[model samples]
Target: MGVVEALVGATVFDGETRRHGVAVLVTDGRIAAVLPEHAVPAGAVVTDLGGGLLTAGFIDAQVNGGGGVMLNDGPTADAMAAIARAHRPYGTTALLPTLITDTPAATAAAIAAAIEAAPTRPGVIGLHLEGPHLAPARRGAHVAELMRPLTEADADQLVAATEAIGVLMVTVAVEQAPPRLIRRLADGGVVVSLGHTDATYDDVVRAVDAGARGATHLFNAMSPLGHRAPGMAGAALDAGSLWCGLIADGHHVHPATLGIAIRGKRGPGRCFLVTDAMSTVGTEGTTFLLNGRTARRENGRLTLDDGTLAGADIDMAASVRLLVERVGVDADEALRMASAWPADYLGIAEMRGRIRAGLQADLVHLSDRLEVKATWIAGERDEA
Candidate 1:
């Protein structure tokens, strides 16, 4: 009925596994079918990729900045559009424009920007509020002065805001915000995540009970797992109900450590990848401001003058490459970590994360070397 196109000749990673000599049909900006190459319908337009890897486009839930624009700099629709354009080249079809620790007024501005941008910006799914309600001691690049406990009024505002913005993910320290607030946020359709905390195992469990379903940049800003104490990191790995977002830039986490987290994490709750990218992601710029302090990008790492690690400087494609080449992750599973897992965590898998029928036709074609050759966002192809 609608205009139909077939993509053939690639090893298709259908979000969960790989299939060979397959063809995917796109109609009206959604996948119509995935079948063998020979099964393509008559008169269907076809594009043969010549034997490379085809998979769902990367979905990053944590993106601080890109395209020379940081959310902290503008927190406007224009800034969100710029960030989306910057990451598109690297195969990220959808992302959450993250706002790190900032003032309450700044937070409100960011939410307003996201609400204004979401309808027009196809790539921005929602907003990731990463702080302002974090533990001061673990606030890596956040301004300690700005970090505070979550008040009832703040909780009500966040809940109300989610009605306008589709997904409002707030990263809070459970040690600071009580279980009741976590429950309130979850009840209000906010995706509550735990991060930047010094909470022990019990605290994390209590947060989980209150519907905190994810961990922010696990093992980086949170308390480490102790053999005797079992902190938030331990709970993250042990909890089968939580999804942990890992920064696989090979800088925030060691290769061996990442491998362990990947293997140790149980099902229904897996470790997925996030770029945690900064302003240097798609631009040649090497430095940016984080909470008014200079965050310089050198040697593939972003850090403050005092060597405190800020957001990462990697992109989604690079994160996938690092996971496969350095961390010894299976290519298929690594791809899932970048796309499907994150989509599932964000509760958008049915539409955006996979190459199955009825899903939006968001996909990427990568060469044997894992370089992005082209990307299709909602069935519109952009060739590199």
Candidate 2:
């Protein structure tokens, strides 16, 4: 009989707290235990990684595409696989492949493909339908023809259809989503996020009360916060409980503003980082088509040729590095931003975020330079 335990020697970061020099034990595809320095388990497969830092594998609740596949351009199981392969080495363990606003048939097809893919590919969480329910005034990069105001029937049918197919997230503008849609989704086990909105502070309060607990991409694709009206952006900024996703690509939100969001949400449900990356993410040569527009990479960011905010060209690691280097956040804090916070927002914190015992063995190893050295998921190391 063979032992099924594995040991990750030396580097460890518990994801929520701080770093440690420990040996992480994995057995039967879950983290069995974590032993401290100099503690060795007999007959275990030991991978002596020396001094590389290891933390929980990143979970992106929002991802569109990577490698060469755009989930929006006919998303499929293969597309999801391509996305995962592209992001895996970059340190993402699991992800929800998002499909931006498109026709109903297209949306339904993407949902079906995601359902078909989810069982086979554990890397994929589900599908995030980012629109068809957005305020047209703030429909960033999304096709205006596909945008629709959320009505009761639209909400009901969408919930039913997506729930039936295992798709579990939707992003809507508070200003346009139906009266109690947020509450209903929250109750129905769907994660709701606010974006592409122009709601006033009062309207935001109403939505929060109705169960919208997260803001999509903080300051982008929504009304900017100003002193006079204190738009939805302000409401999100001040909402201590809301999970704010900041694109740390330096283009979406400036580094200074990123610091403010981190400061504001630094408590219970603090800020986090996301790639919000588009199709060209993993491909070389720096160009891809977003909704028929040609997006190019310039100065470490991705955008349309005329400079529309297309999406991030960076990966989760770059976002983390930006936080540590530019925003002056400590490495452990930045690690939490990329791992734990986002996991908590999706309500999967218990499973994949933190590097605690009984959690899934989804972990990333980074060199001193903050580059990805390796990644492991459920006791198996990936292509680094």
Candidate 3:
């Protein structure tokens, strides 16, 4: 009943299979149909994509900042919008504006911001609170002093946050957030992910049993996979229900290690790519402040003065390309990792993650070589 538009001239991957000679029809901000090119409605407005690949847009679950804005510095709706806008050019049509470990006041502000922006910002889906509750030993770039045990009041606030934000992902360490608390958060509809942890296999098992559905940036800040210990990384790989986020940027993870993890990972809960990006992304800035510490960008890597990896400088398109070209994953599967898998991890698969009829028309136009050319969020082309 609304204005209809047909996106044509590109090979379309509907998050499952690729098809040629088809047009994706959009109406009322949702996908109306995916039909043969010649069958487009007579009155529909048609936009040619110029012979690239049209697929579901990338959905990043962990995004710290972009467009020279850090969520921690200003946890506001505008900041969330800016971050989203920056990534849109790189094919990320949906993302969680993530907050690194910070004060309780900052955390509250981020929740409020997400609540306000979730409805207005098409690209911002929710908020990812990466921690104030984490183990000090594995606290990569997070201020160790700020890391503490999850309090009762904190749990209550987080549960209340889920009601408004709809998808609040909280990363915690088992040592900081107990299994009982994990269950409480899960019951409150909070997506609990284990991260910045030094937990052994048994510890991770308990957390997984308590409904911790994911692992954040697998194998980077967590315990390594030792033959005798079988730490969080091992448990993450062994557990079929735990979806893990892998930072495919070569600096964060080695290609050989990534290859091994991808091949060895089990079913139902696949290993997906996450940027774990920072403020420097989509900008030419050389450095930024993280928890009052300076993180410099050099040689395609972001690192603190002391040489600890802060956050990635890569974008979603580059991540997918790395997975396929360097890590040896199938191109389709790599794209799924950036789009479908993360949407599934956030429990929004039905609403997004695919180019199916009835889903939101969030799509990306990428060249055959995997460079992003344009993006569409909710059926509107992002000219930014």
Off by over 4 Å in 1: none
- What TM-score quantifies how close candidate 1 is to the native fold? 0.98
Clashes of 2: 1
lDDT of 3: 0.94
lDDT score at residue 180, model 3, on the 0-100 scale: 91
Over the stretch 221-307, how does candidate 2's per-residue lDDT look in tens digits? 888889898798888888777788888888888899988878776357678777887877777857777777787877777776667
What C-alpha lDDT values do all the predictions have? 0.92, 0.80, 0.94
The clash count for each model shown is 0, 1, 0
List TM-score per model, in order. Answer: 0.98, 0.95, 0.99
lDDT of 3 by residue, 38-122 (tens): 9998999999888989999999999999989999999999999999998999999999999999998999999999999998987
True-structure RMSD for candidate 2:
1.9
Q: Candidate 3: lDDT of 197?
A: 96
